[model samples]
Target: MPHYKKTKIPLLWLRRHTSDREFMLISSVLVGLTAGMAAVILKTLVHYIHVLLAYGNRLLDQPYWLVVFPIIGILLTVFVVRVAFNGSIGRGTAGVLFSISQKSSMVERHKMYSHVVTSAFTAGFGGSAGLESPIVVTGSAIGSNYGRDYHLNYRDRTLLLAAGAAAGIAAVFNAPIAGVLFAIEVLLTDISISAFIPLIISAVVGALCSKLILQEEILFNIGQREFFAASHLPFYVLLGVLCGMMSVYYTRMALRVEELFEEYQSKVYSRAIVGGILLGLLIMLFPPLFGEGYDSIRLLEGNNAQEMLQNSWLAFFGTNEWLVLCFVGALALVKVFAATITIASGGNGGNFAPSMFVGASTGFFFSRLVNLLSFNNLPVSSFAMVGMAGILSGVMHAPLTAVFLIAEITGGYTLMIPLMIVAATSYAMVKYFEPYSLDTKKLAQKGQLLTHNKDRTILRIMKIQHLIETEFQPVSPEATLGELVEVIAHSRRNLFPVVTADRKLDGIILLENVREIMFKTEKYDLVKVRELMVKPPAIVQYDDSMADVMKKFDESGAWNLPVLRNETYQGFVSKSSIFTKYRKLLIKTTNVA
Candidate 1:
């Protein structure tokens, strides 16, 4: 038998030869390519599923089939999650954000393909949702796990995570610029200019994958059009306001519906059944609500709004264009319900596509209404295209991403001015009512949102338990000065906690305060620990937040603070320890590596 020894290279060799930037750039490419491939596969799977289930089929002609297919898709998705994946659908983008903020940019390894399988099943089988979000999750997981495998630091891991997300979004839409902005605006909070290189590289590679392999058509192509005239500015602004209002409604509705489903949290099947039935009925009345509604958006963009309403029950109200316009507007209003229910019912998907769908519908309805009632020939296609940016901006609180994504996908900067106007106006208006985007609200509330602000992000990641020094010895308040002297000699710390017989904190004794009497051993018997101990300016409760702890530290001007639980001494939290931990956390959170 021949024994083979594995060849090994020194870790120092790799670290010495390669710069961190080069390694990150290389990793970004791999992540981009892999994530791009995943996006293509997910999109292709959904296309084939649509072809098999609904396209060119008599089943789609029946209104009842429309009602049944979504139910079946959701049930299949639920089955896959419960049986194969152990009832974990994987948190979509929120999960990605949470990982970046709280989990040290670490995601479950299974997420790389779990979302692909589940979301493909959900959306492909006619569930009313989009694949963009799942792809983002899948991509982020790929990047996160790849970084983890290499034993990369938290900063590099988070950078790769965002790179993967950028690639996924870029590949899905074939819009690389939008992908970069999406990653920067939504996923990455603390980024450096150098970080953009990897993100850009990843996005371009991902977009190339979609363009070269998948040959994905430009999703919403609004053919050559002139820039919006100054005359149309007011209408665009008005449209922005309307979209902003719709965005608010969409956010509130999605959150409320999610809460409603959560009421049956333990009863997954009941939630699925009730949500599916409700979603089905909505689709039955408004056929456009059946799936992602991208096709309906395309119809509106092509000035075929009537075609969207053709299969609806309202088609009986004659082929009236106004009725169709009204129905389109109604779909814009209720599409939020369809989308929220689709996901809330245990289906796998995200709001990325639904937001664009609602935006397109709102723009088309607004433009069409103006064209009918006024002499101004408001370009419906342009508004339809720009409306997507507005709703996307408002819903995601990502105006830059929305604007660039629309400008890129539409194949020109012809609509750039209106896109900016509408998106900015809508975002500003929505910001007045909702501080955080739909995806980030919960994370922000929990202090798990990694914003661009470095200080806050570091503070959020710094755990008080890890910073607390529990090694300080506690001296009984009744202990004689000679006993205190013995404790001080054995202890490594300069501060001592004086506790009662029951372990409750009485006061703290600083070594400096007793330094004068330390050498007077003859008088040691005359001094008692309680007599020398002084009350601290402030004490930190065990459950006190880091913010409160810091505040107490500032107000008291103490080098060390006692941590107590219900008046019982727990440990000592030092200002120096906190500053050291914060410095380390800041380095870890930022792209210092």
Candidate 2:
């Protein structure tokens, strides 16, 4: 039974008296707990599926079954998308980001339940995706549902949603700090000390639950890495540039593949069949492109069959043989193509894993090129990991998360400096390069700016005090027009603030009011300021954001407005003075107006 509707009379009384925020917090905890449990359960289920697939491959004496995992994954994805999700296609993290940036909301409350199930299944079935997106979506949706169910206001609802998203990331990644950072970095788009307290609480709860259920294990099993010498700093710098260029390539390729699949998937099963065929053919040469590429990274890093080619740049192309390079490169290109089609053709998935796969391969290839030139004292495997981290950081532009994730997974603090250098270089290289990742681009296309690191707060631009217009004589609401005219004649102000006998604001009366009265012969002497006062004028609290105030100014069409708080009337604000000061400051700072 729902909390409010328990089969007891006292429960209804308790629900009616308690504040809605308390209820949402209680419900959000439940959501986080449940989402954590779901993640654990789904992870176990996916592990079992992997084991079964591995056993089947051993029995059948064919490794192709592993390549076919994505195909099975996509099929199961289609069923969930079609049935459980009720045909709500494109329900992924990018979708959630697009929705939130554009609408200030995540999944609709009505669709929350279906979205969680479908997203969990998509990742669990080997969709070449990560669980972070699902965790974010599930947590955010749960928060939104809690807000709606408990009757919180819009602002509180938005906060709860962000809190839930943070919890989800914390639970799935087992990185509580990173989860909180992701919320502040990507979703909230602003930092506040007060907001952190509740969000931190939620994140701690989520992380603790995950730790209690599943013991701490680094997601990637990276062994001891040989550190690069200081002499190799210049070479790592070059790797940074390569990672940046490769990031742009991945973004372009992913979008192009999405467009191609969207245009070609009209015929039933065409995208699926073509994607399956391409993936099957590609795995023949470079079996590394299959799944999340975690195993591929391990194979390349460990004592594998392929040795680092020190004499050839062709190895940088992802294969040793010139003919094989062309084939493997073409196949790697096609794998990205198929992954894009998998999502565009109604498959529920995320681009995070695929982007990392491309990045890792790019880095691995770059390492070969660096080694080929007789570059000394550089660990090629470490370079590969840097490239992986760089590409993902560049595309996602969540550098801290990318860097920390790579450091944690690799179990190497020595790699942090190089990792940060490469990641920062990639991020800068992409500046105004592609308008902040593919997901942000979608938001832009939908007419939302969603720019990063903006100073849109009131404290950034608000002035201490400006032009209070004391020339404007305060008029009593009961004053006659003749007396107001005498008062106006002595003052140079175009607007006057009218107050009641108790000194509370009545309304603003403009010169246009007198002009309207002058047209009627009898009104000139008979009318009072009370009769002419504009009722229900716009009012603002002093601490409100200037952006919000500006929006209100636009909506209300008030050149001068009253300020109020706690039933007390403060001074008025003139839009002209604010704008004039703003213009001068912009000029002084040499900022674009």
The local distance difference test score of each candidate is: 0.85, 0.62
lDDT by residue for model 1 over 445-493, one digit each (tens)? 7777765455765676566777778899999988889999999999988
Q: Looking at candidate 1, what is the lDDT of residue 87? A: 87
Taking all chains together, the TM-score of candidate 1 against the true structure is: 0.92
Measure candidate 2: CA RMSD: 10.9
Q: In model 1, where is the ten-residue run with the lowest total lDDT?
A: 1-10
Highest TM-score, which number?
A: 1
How badly does each model clash, as a count of residue pairs? 1, 0
Give lDDT tens digits, candidate 2, residues 1-593. 87545633453454587765455455556656755655555445555555565454452135465346556666666666556555554555565554454454545754445545554454444455555566677777777666665565555566677777777777765666666776766666654566676576677677767777764442444765678567777877888887788778777887887777767655535665566555544443445544455665665555241532221233465544443324323433554664565566555556666666666666666665555556654576787777767877887777776787677557667888888899889888976587667666655554343334333321244542443434557888888887777787787777788877776888877887676564565665688788888863577666665666677778889787776655455667778877876665333322111
Count of backbone collisions within predicted model 2: 0
User: In angstroms, how far off is 163's CA in candidate 2?
Assistant: 3.1
lDDT of 2: 0.62
